[model samples]
Target: MDTSGSLSITHLIFNASPLVQIVMLFLLGLSIASWTIIFSKSNSYKAARAKADEFEDKFWSGIDLNNLYQECIKKGQDLIGLEVIYSSGFKEFVRLINSGPADQEVVMDGTYRQMKVSQSREMENLESHLATLATIGSISPYIGLFGTVWGIMHAFIALAAVKNATLSMVAPPIAEALIATAMGLFAAIPAVMFYNRFVSKVEALENRYINFMDEFATILNRRLVRVRSEMNMKNNDVPQTNTQQPSSSYSQKSYNHPLGEEQHSPYSRARANTHSSPYQTPGVEGDRYRNTSRSPLQGQ
Candidate 1:
């Protein structure tokens, strides 16, 4: 009700019942919250996308994995998105490899697990406040409808007391009630749209992380294989045969005897006697003249 009998949004809002005004206030709050989330997520998603693109470029630029890991560590707390996943995996890998000999499968599994945990953490960060946004989108319109219904009911009740219902009397309250549904739609539409958009973006990022993890794991495995192959080649390049004597050396030596050597051998069995006995027995002389004994000479 104004001086010219003209009703505006302000008039409808102010002249609205306590309950209706409360509903409007509540819808306004939802609208405000939704917008805030929209803006915040817009910025967050933009930054996330940019960071992901930059990381992908760096990762695929033929840079050494160790070098990339070192760079990520230097970034420290400023690391985001794919960098976090890569650094976590690489750190775990280094620790496992340096910890000593271990099952290669176990090492790779641990690395992948660490990366998965990091990916989950990133997803959590991105998905925060999304549920609240969905809730507001779903419930705001119904809440507005309830407010409109209440206002219309209150309007009809007032008209019953006045025995006359004119356009001026009828239109304002109905318009006020309709404003509630309008507010409801306003709060809900953007919330729904933006919620869907953010969810899609989040899913895309998740897939990206997963794909990267698989590719990264493959790269690490290849590196491991290459290192092992190189080590094998080095080992093969070394001489490992045992030293042995020639056949001629074996022939020159015997059991406990060295033939053709001046040294007396413990196994010498063909040594000549140095002394000969001149005395001989009678029968051993075989009838030789020297066989005559001294007793025969005395008889002569």
Candidate 2:
């Protein structure tokens, strides 16, 4: 076999019809773009997963929530995925708590909403350019097939013009046209594979983020409950002695002689003093004294 006449890739491309060449060039461009997206998306997914892993390790390490929130803030924009969700949630939690009149359910609701919004934005960022990959995967093969069909049609037309057509004259153009389909498949396969892989990865990461959000919300809810209980306890334990004393004094001055001096009895004096006592039940002790005094009079 003389290898001197063998066609190279460059030769096939150059020797192809104008329409086939255009198809080939278009497929080539798509291939290049898909590979570029693959490399970039590969790096992005890897980094996002790594950051999520790191943040989860730190989050579940039993460190204080405040400390974790502070650390994430220090990391600033470097925080990705779950870290961003955690930071946004905790920040909102703290803001609502510190702003006074802390309603635990309200705070948690706000925090959860903020985290969900952040998660959604992060998912969008992670899924960027995926549509382009899918388009390339689905359309590349059809584009290549179109080129092949056009080349075959052209070849048949040219063959009709010839007085004596042979296999040698027909085979080359058909083969060259098929190269478009080959390029299309080459471009489509990896795009499809990586697209599926990345989609799974993004979903996994998304699930991880959602789980973290739930867990973080649980921790926050517990803390909010504890703080609210503590505040309620403190409020209950507060002494109202100062407020009581003034009210008792006013009552005694206003009602010192309900029956007047002429009708005063030992029971009447006891009743007056009882009414002045701040902690005593109103009228009960006075009624008991009056009944005892009347019983003594009845016995006499």
Candidate 3:
């Protein structure tokens, strides 16, 4: 008996039964594909993590929004988190200011809506293609099992037709079938591990975006509140036309009007009315306006 470690891999393939050979080939392909995805995803995730870190640092550093937006635009997919936030908040702010009377309340509401939508969209994008990885991880072993089972059945059928039954003949086919199973596990284990890891990373990034959104919105809210307060103070200092008669006359006008009709102004009635046009209402024009008035502060 001669044992040579120099035996060629091709010799092993040639000696394998057709069924086992096919299974081996299929397993090899699967392993290659799995490894390709693994490497691609590993690099992709690393890049994403780096991009997220860089963008968040810049975002929290108090960079100007326009400048930030420009930078995000330049980076595009690289800075997905920052891009989403900027697009959502900035677009809504622009739309609201352009369309609505410069009311702080309206602006803030619109910005909030946009930011929420943007964050959701960004998360979706970040997690894209993850499902494929999950599917491959979950099903690879079963696919390999199928190939193994088919090869084993074919191996038995071949032996039955050969008229000679020997343990030596049986063992090689069984060995080859087991190889398919091993390959399946090789493909599956990494995929499952990576899928779970990537999912956790995505969630962490999403939480960061959300927290930043909340903090940024709060900042805007504070700014808007102060501006609105200053505008209210200015409005209070303005001279009231009717003075002593402002209350009684305004009440009479309200009483004469229907519930949904022209109601009396909130400034005179002190009822916190909702219909007064922030920009066009006469009473609110340089008069003591209620803080509940849904209007952009003049300065904002």
Candidate 4:
């Protein structure tokens, strides 16, 4: 049986029709290429997941944002996955804030957009070459089936040339033709299995990235809100001296009473002219000072 199997694989391939031989070679090439993709994708996914995990731990560990951003910049393009997303969002946050005070909503919107773009790029990197695997898995079996059909058709035609047909006459050619189908299944099954497996991994990674992005955005939004609030407070505390200046000038003009006689005036125009003051005290004390100054002006 081992001898028959060995001959079936080796000898049959050598004696197979040119079309069948070509089909087998094609399937073999596809199988080789599929395996290469599978192994490469496996390593890539593994590294991506590892990096994501590492970065997530660091991100949630209460590290400072600036420190993390600086570190990512130092890493340069080597940063991947969640690291890239975090860096992109934070970088946009810093840029928007540094350019000038932006509304919290606008800052968050820009940060989220940047992170989303990074997420898509990272997903593309993670999913690269998966289509080839899928194509190989989907089409390999059909190609093998086509080879089998063609080989079987040739086998039947060869039998038609025979005067008498027997199991011995029919079995070898039929078995050789069926090898095409076997080769197809051989190339397709692993590809389909691995493709499904890798797709699941990619999806899981994508979910993790999305969740992290949302959480990071929330953190960034809070920071932006806090920053905006502090800036508002500073602006409010600045004291609008320019606006008060006009009010003060108007008050001084009214108190001066340029047309009134100095003795008759309730407040002295000479004092107002001498002071030329923009600030004036208000309430009863100010009234007392005006009355006292008026008494001096009246005595004069």
**Top candidate when judged by lDDT against the true structure:** 1
Tens-digit lDDT track of model 3 for 1-300: 016534344554566667666766766776677667667766765665566556555554545554666666676565466567865686566455444235677778889888988888777876877787787788778877876797688789889898879886777666666666776788788778878877776766666667667656665566445434544554476577746553433333321211233345332233233243222212332122222221222111
Q: What is the per-residue lDDT of model 1 for residues 15-44, given as tens digits with 9 covering 90 to 100?
A: 888999999999999999999999999888
Q: Which scores greater on TM-score, model 2 or model 3?
A: 2
- Residue lDDT tens for model 4, 1-300: 155543446777777889998999999999999999999998888888778657755665555566667789999879988889987887776666544434668877998999999999999998899999999999999999988888889999999988989977777676777888898999999999999988888877887778777766766665444434543454456567755553322233222222222322213323333333211222343334333322211121
Q: What is the lDDT of residue 96 in candidate 1?
A: 72
lDDT-best of 1 and 2 = 1
The estimated TM-scores of all candidates read 0.78, 0.78, 0.68, 0.76
lDDT of 2 by residue, 11-125 (tens): 7778889999999999999999999999999889888867865666565555556567778889877888888898788777656654545456787899999999999999999
Between which residue pairs do clashes occur in model 2?
Answer: none
Task: Report lDDT per candidate.
Answer: 0.73, 0.72, 0.60, 0.70
Give the clashing pairs for model 4. none
Residue 238 in model 3: shift from native, Å? Answer: 4.4
Error of 2 at 192 (Å): 0.6
